[model samples]
Target: MPVPLIWLIAALALAGAEVLTGDLFLLMLSGGALAAAASSWLLALPVWVDGLVFLLVSVLLLVGVRPAIKRRMQSGKGLLDPAKALEGKSALVLDRVARHEGQVKLDGEIWTARPHVETDVYEAGDQVTVVHIDGATAVVAKIV
Candidate 1:
């Protein structure tokens, strides 16, 4: 069997493994295998030279390019959950809310609420801004 054919098979196997893993490391190794294949089949290089080409390309990709790929993949903020959607949104007070107790209608649904500032109170029909969410409750402040 040709040395290039062996490299080609190894490349294909590594590429398939890369698909399953989702990490770029295996893909870099597959790229190295492809370089070895090219060196053997295209350049007709000796076995030692082809092995060296593979090792160089694979190490370069792993050390030089992998971190940038991982960083780009992780740069974006993750999708917001429904509760996070209410952050800084205005809501209507459904019941009088004091230091530690209140109710408000947010996005057409009633949620347990509390004044963000202990000294502030929200009366029924008052508008409040949801500052944050604490488990099942909305921490709100009187809309200025």
Candidate 2:
């Protein structure tokens, strides 16, 4: 019945949904709602002010804090291994790579591959290096 209690309940529900979905968005809203509940309790704010505070805090947490957290989590993770370095990592061609058909290989295990250039075709059993990975396919250049 009380505004503070309603905000608290909404916050808990959002947090519970976040746990179930494993998405970070709901958690941000939960934080905002909790802030609103606190404001309601501390200042005895009107319902509209509580709602406004919730919206502002939710946007701030999602847009500001979420990105910072994501950056910290992703930081220091390079796209490629330093040892492999895209220069000389060996791969075996498992399929004929045409301009559009692409290639396949066992890069540790079987993987779909694509040649770097349409002009550079490769047959099965051809040794290649992993120049880059594009989506599900490995873009390869001919070895030797």
Q: Candidate 2 on 1-144: residue-level lDDT in tens?
A: 989999999999999999987658999999999999999999997999999999999999999998888778679666665434543567877778767775565436676777787688888888988777666667788877
Report clashes for each candidate as comma-separated counts. Answer: 0, 0
Q: List the residue pairs that clash in candidate 1.
A: none
After superposition, which runs of candidate 2 have C-alpha atoms over 4 Å from their true positions? 76-144
Residue 13 displacement in candidate 2 (angstroms): 0.9
Strongest candidate by lDDT: 1
**Local distance difference test, each candidate:** 0.93, 0.82
Cα-based lDDT at residue 21, candidate 2: 76
Cα lDDT of model 1 by residue, 51-110, tens digit:
999999999999999999999999988888878899999999999999778899999999
TM-score of each: 0.63, 0.52
Q: Given candidate 2, what's the lDDT at residue 95? A: 76
